[model samples]
Target: MIISFVQTKGGTGKSTLALSTAFSNHMNSAFGSVALVELDPQGTLRNWWNERTELGRDTGRVSFHHISSSQKEVFADGIKAIATHNDLIVMDIPGESTGKLHTRFACAVSDLVIIPMRTSTNDEAAFADNLYPIIKEILKVDPGKKGCFYVLPSFTHPKANRDTIMGYFTDILPPHVGCLRTIYPDRSVYENFNREGATLADYAYSVRENKRHSKQALSAAGDVEEIARAITQMLEKEHVSAKKEEATLRG
Candidate 1:
């Protein structure tokens, strides 16, 4: 399965969420091999991946790929090559500054396109003015992509009600766009977790001696694990539905 974390507006936690999800235990166990692909030319993840390498950290089942090309053909060919060897591909797309080129391509190719948005006026407006149009265009071309686009509520208050946040997105989401049942809560841990190219798990381990910091780190990790589980479940269900449709057609 191929999943892309895409948002037209920057500072929406796209890169962080994409990396954390790829590193999550659920995703690692669900797929044999996973590829973390960065479509951003700015190289936010490229720098981080380099740090991981320099530090000699183990990547385990995840491999990193950076494709800075804006050409659709190049993107297609490169991702296809990566997909051939990997069970799952998690992509981090660039923001609106790229002319929405990467945004449109990622939405078109990904099995699931996750848009991380905070519950705020600016985010809602950005989606309406920028991202949703591309989503609409894709759905116009292929109606089967309906459930492929999901809105992940990001930077939500840690103590906020999940149902309330989910309902907010549900009420405002355009046709064919669905909302994830989980939220990426705002926590101090997220801001500091990636120091020295550390993963959330690594951060948690390092802060184990400090009770407050350790608790925050664990909670943030739990949030990522839940999101990963939700994504895998969605893909598995889609696979079953596709098989059923195929059998029905044959019958």
Candidate 2:
């Protein structure tokens, strides 16, 4: 399965979410070989992975790949090559600053396209102007992609009500774009967790002495796990639906 975290607008915490999701315990347990692929030319994740290598940290079940190619053919071929060996390919797609080339490509190829967005009016407007149009275009070309796109509420207040947040997105999102059941809450730990290529698990272990920090890390880790679990559940549902469709056609 291929899952992509994509946003046309930057600074939505999509990269961090992508990395944590790849490292999430749920993802590792569900997928045998997980490959985290970065399509950003800016190389945000490349730096982090380099640090991990310098620190002599092992990736274990998860491996990292950086594909900075702008050509769709090259990008698609690279992802396809990775997907052959890996059970899951989680992509961190770059924000479409110059153009929506990467965004469009990622959306079209991914089994699940996760858009990390905020509840702000500016983000809503940006999506309406930029990302939503791409989604609509894709759906027009292939209606089967109706269930492939989802919006994830990012940087939400930890104390915020889940139902209210999900409801807000549900009302605004278009027909084909669904809202995820889980939210990525804003936490101080997230800001500092990735320092020196450290994963959330590493950060939690490092801050074990501080009760408050440890608790926050635990909560953030839980959020990533929930998001990963939700993605896996959605994939399972889509798989079943596809099988039934095949059976019906055969009948």
Q: Per model, how many backbone clashes are there?
A: 0, 0
Error of 1 at 154 (Å): 1.1
lDDT of each: 0.91, 0.91
The CA lDDT at 149 in model 2 is 90
Per-residue lDDT of 1-251 in model 1, one digit per residue for the tens?
89999999988888999899999999999999999999999999999999998999889999999998868999999999999999999999988887888998999998888889999989999999999989999999987787888898999998899999988998888888889888888887888799788999999999999999999999999999999988887787767876787799899
- In model 2, pairs of residues that clash are none
Q: For model 1, where is the 10-residue window of minimal lDDT?
A: 233-242
Cand. 1 Cα-lDDT: 0.91
Q: Give the C-alpha miss distance for residue 172 in model 2, angstroms.
A: 0.6
Query: In angstroms, how far off is 149's CA in candidate 2?
Result: 0.8
